[model samples]
Target: MMTDAGEQLEVQLDDCPPGRETFNDPLQEDASGPDSHLSSALRELEEPLLLLADVALAPPCGRAVFYSCPEAERVERSLQSVQLQLHFLLSKADDLHDCLLGGQGHVEREALAAAISSLLYTCQPYFNHLESTARSTMAQYTHVPADMCSTLLDFSQQLCDKLEQLVLTYASYGLLSLNEAEPDSASHFCVGQTQLGQLKLTIFRYCQPTPYLSRANTQLYKRMRWNVERVRDQQQTEEEDGDDEEETFTDYYFLCYEDIPNPHAEANEDSEGVSDGSVVRMWSIGQWVQANPDPSTEDIWDWILCEVPQGGYNRLLFLGHDEPSSRSATDYLQQLLLSCCTD
Candidate 1:
């Protein structure tokens, strides 16, 4: 996954500027003695850092270990990734107790509890997809006793519900439910064969862009953020500059504009069976960088790439194959349209 450019970047990080390390804050020296408390503070931090590092980099074990499952390597990878992601999060939890004993450990309880609860609440889409993929694996090749998948899911959801209540007392940045239709939103689109009656516009359900989409059907995901949707703070701020905060927050940047009508819709693009989204998509990503946030043709990019500079596009999309997967994608582009002509 690490590209040549990425590997080069990694190598460059180890070669810091020649004189960078000699720099230090004069105020810090003044506050402490000649040696400064820096030596002691660094010593204290080293133990905790190593403790966490050990918990993280140690070999996998228990349920966290990857199963030597049957074929369908793609499916296995997906399942393993989810498990590993959770395992890493749990390792951090375990290290907390080891690094900070008793009284200090207990103090973190409220924050951890709230975080876990919030993650579950905000990650319904992830759970739903995970469960479905898990079930596919279970039914196709194996089995779980008593349909425990549903049982576990229900239990987890309920636990999260209880945790959600605890979050009410705190100032929460509740996630935007972008998949759901807004009252005045005019943007809408469909998936898999743009049909007069066939429609599916739900995207942004996943917290971030998903990987390994090739395992399933032909799918697509695109995001477009311009001078888009401006969401306001639900709870009015009590700060003296609350009015400014409210005014500043009122502008919305609609992240993904779904279902750009097929450029040749008259030619029946969806009749071939694929989604048609409108937002401008990346011709290629990870290898390119655009500094400007605004869409403008007149820029330095034109000379560098010898192509007319188009606009800024940082959104990620998983444009799946021409065929359908065992499961399908429901998500992408906007502005004047997605084309190589711009970028």
Candidate 2:
């Protein structure tokens, strides 16, 4: 996806200097001493710093570890950023609790709760994605060095635990949803934890590489997980005799127009309207359906991928394939178009 020049730029960007650490806050320093109880408590509360050395440099387990890669290191840095942000907000939460309990007005307390909720909401998706990627990466490891796989799982488990605590704390303070029906708890957290556990279980069940995919075998189990529509289709097909569906088409039309600026325009707004290059692709799908109410099965694929071009726009279709399972049908559609283009 990247050109040689682009790759060189990426390498240069990666070589940029690391910024100074801001872990120490002079204002938060205790007057007593480093050994003071307050200072010690604050130090203990510092967030977890994900270190690549801690994860990858340890004794080798029988199974391979995913953290040996540079990409994994970048992931670790991102995780550390999230952890640090969580800790920062947690300290604020503690302050707000103290302020509210000290008879602060409802408005201020409500605002603090809102702040906490916003921060936690922002974190949910990032951590969820991170955990998902980690699970998928671990699945690729065949003979996971016993030391590597278990240690990596342990790191993932720790991250999950930290996120869970933060979510529960925010919920307790009325800043987050504790609803079982909500995606945060029921969908995201549950699925993430389950996936992480499955990763560990894969390594556990299969001391060595095995063909079978269980919660234990990363590749087999993870890949086999079907999407909702596919599952539903399977269920329906099983109930019936898996009869093929017929296709139909009908005609549809829309008014065509060239770029014409609207009469009403604000001073700051551009009055030129859409560019002349802009084109609208129109097709009579309804007419096509009416023309062939029961078209041949073989024609469907072609019909879908067929391109319909108009003045300025074009429409192309793509078919989904099951493979290493990286990109979706939509992602491949762009590539398909590029492939058809003149060099």
Candidate 3:
């Protein structure tokens, strides 16, 4: 037993197709008593009651739906549903304002704003998605009233502000934890990029600590570059003369480090120019083996342990080139030295 306006409002609120029940009767009442009869009547009157309140409350029972949702995911889903309902309601109102009232689509502005604000507040966990959704939906309306458009734009801006604040909070906490973990590690780590001909080369340098030995500090360097070169020759004349060659490319990796200066060089003056302290100590950790001239068909790099030159051996350099993998460069270097000693 619904009025014409009630039926119209119900039809507008029903986003589902024809013959589908939009609401479920959760409280089944018995006709045995007066209280039961009253409860059943109230249940039947719910839709009409919401329709009557829609004009004043805007999104009829959206607040109740939002607050009833317990979890974050459920709250977000409910908010989305409410937003869709509001959008449909606004569209219907706009049609009525243009066709029946013969006026600007201004009546639904308050309702639309209220729905947007409720969604923004309720779906805090999905703020990022909310901003995108609002922007996309707002873009779809080419003839929306000025007031409604302004409201939507304002809500979108608010969402952006909230998201930016959250990102700053996360970044601050991450930086604080990083500082606490290693205060001075940033000073030792360095990265640079340079152009080697047409190719780009990246250089990484860092200080590696040797805790067990007195000569405990060394500088580690890694260079990475890509190379394109000739891999094959089709003709015997081209192969011998290096004229016509097939080209191929591959990534090149080089690992090397600064060698610790000879500590006993200061004590022994006879050590070759040792007291001068002007000599540079550099050690290459990997060797290049030209198994094939063609770059595409061969493994050109080999890793090996270099023997320390004779007569300068204060202690044989034990470089750990093997250990459990880690993201830490210093720890990896120590593990490499430990591996060399064990082997």
Candidate 4:
């Protein structure tokens, strides 16, 4: 739970710099049991929790800040503390959910439920951003041991579990009332509007190392669940019987310099018939309609936004090595923004 702070967490960190902060422990000496356990976890967290909070609460600025390598001991300690905290938090949340005095509807009406929902809703982008930046931001930049990989994976699952539990507990309950009309209650959602000629783009870096989401099928497995390797085996199982052929694989453009051989050179030509050595492709509502010959394409777009799963989308693959320290998606992102402004 991020409290409304007097100053931004970023400013506090710059001035106090984590370990240097003079933090007075708020735990009363008389406390025992669960309270004592929580206090101990918090005490161990000290500064690393603040760093996590800062990242969680910060606005999505479309830039990945890979932390400079830290002492291995510090990294392990920080990760361990987070694991401990998450375990306690999940246990307590489950306990509270079970002990609620009234029915689910009654619990949903409580301000506590609404507040928790709001906080989690606000953090929707944070986890998505984390999934995108997990590889380079932590392991590659932190320079930690290979042994930490399992620990890190366990932490990731625990974090995801906490999120799943909370969502199941309060997502629709706190946000939507059974009595209220869909249009009225749905107004609380993070909705966007677009007019004719409108174009909105958000940039994100790919940081998932394991599967790396290289293709539509690989990305599809990730959305199905994180155990992608297993998904490959169980994909055609009777339980998951569905029309696999309907699943679309995005056509991708291999982006590289003029010196590099164009993968699609045989068909290379721009709308204006000018090749500036830049591979090009596009996706839009209009283009989507044109690409798919389905008669219900427009209607499909309207209802499918909520049902649309992550994956099966075309992703840009750069030819060169993506150096964590020297160059990453952030640098290319800067140029994209500059070009947008230039146009």
Worst 10 residues of 3 by lDDT: 25-34
Model 3 TM-score? Answer: 0.18
Model 1: lDDT to the true structure: 0.29
Query: Which structure among the candidates has the greatest TM-score?
Result: 4
Q: Give candidate 2's whole-model lDDT.
A: 0.32
* Candidate 3, 88-133: lDDT as tens digits: 3344434423332232344443233222222222222122222222
Per-residue lDDT of candidate 2, residues 224-297 (tens digit): 11111111244555567565553222212111112224345443533775444243322110001212223444
Better of 2 and 3 by TM-score: 2
Stretches of candidate 3 off by over 4 Å are: 1-245, 249-255, 260-264, 267-280, 283-287, 290-343
Number of clashes found in candidate 3: 4
TM-score (all chains, Cα) for each model: 0.19, 0.29, 0.18, 0.32
Alpha-carbon shift of residue 77 in model 3 (angstroms):
48
Report the error of model 3 at residue 76, Å.
49
lDDT tens string, model 1, 1-343? 1133223322332232322243232111011111342223222212321222122222334333232344235433433444443343233334323332342544454444333322332233233333332232223222332233444334333333332233332213231222212431111211111111111111122222222121322133322112212234435553544464443221112233223344543433366665455323422111113333333555666557643322233434434323211122221222112232256
Q: Please, what are the lDDT tens digits per residue for candidate 4 over residues 101-216?
A: 35455643454443433332222233233222333233334333334434443444454445445544554555333221232221122111111112222221111121223223
Error of model 3, residue 244, in angstroms: 8.7
Question: Candidate 3, after superposition: displacement of residue 27 in Å?
Answer: 60
For model 4, the superposed segments whose C-alpha errors exceed 4 Å read 1-73, 99-112, 119-133, 169-343
Clashes of each: 19, 25, 4, 0
Where does candidate 4 have its weakest 10-residue lDDT segment?
Answer: 221-230
CA lDDT, candidate 2, residue 198: 16
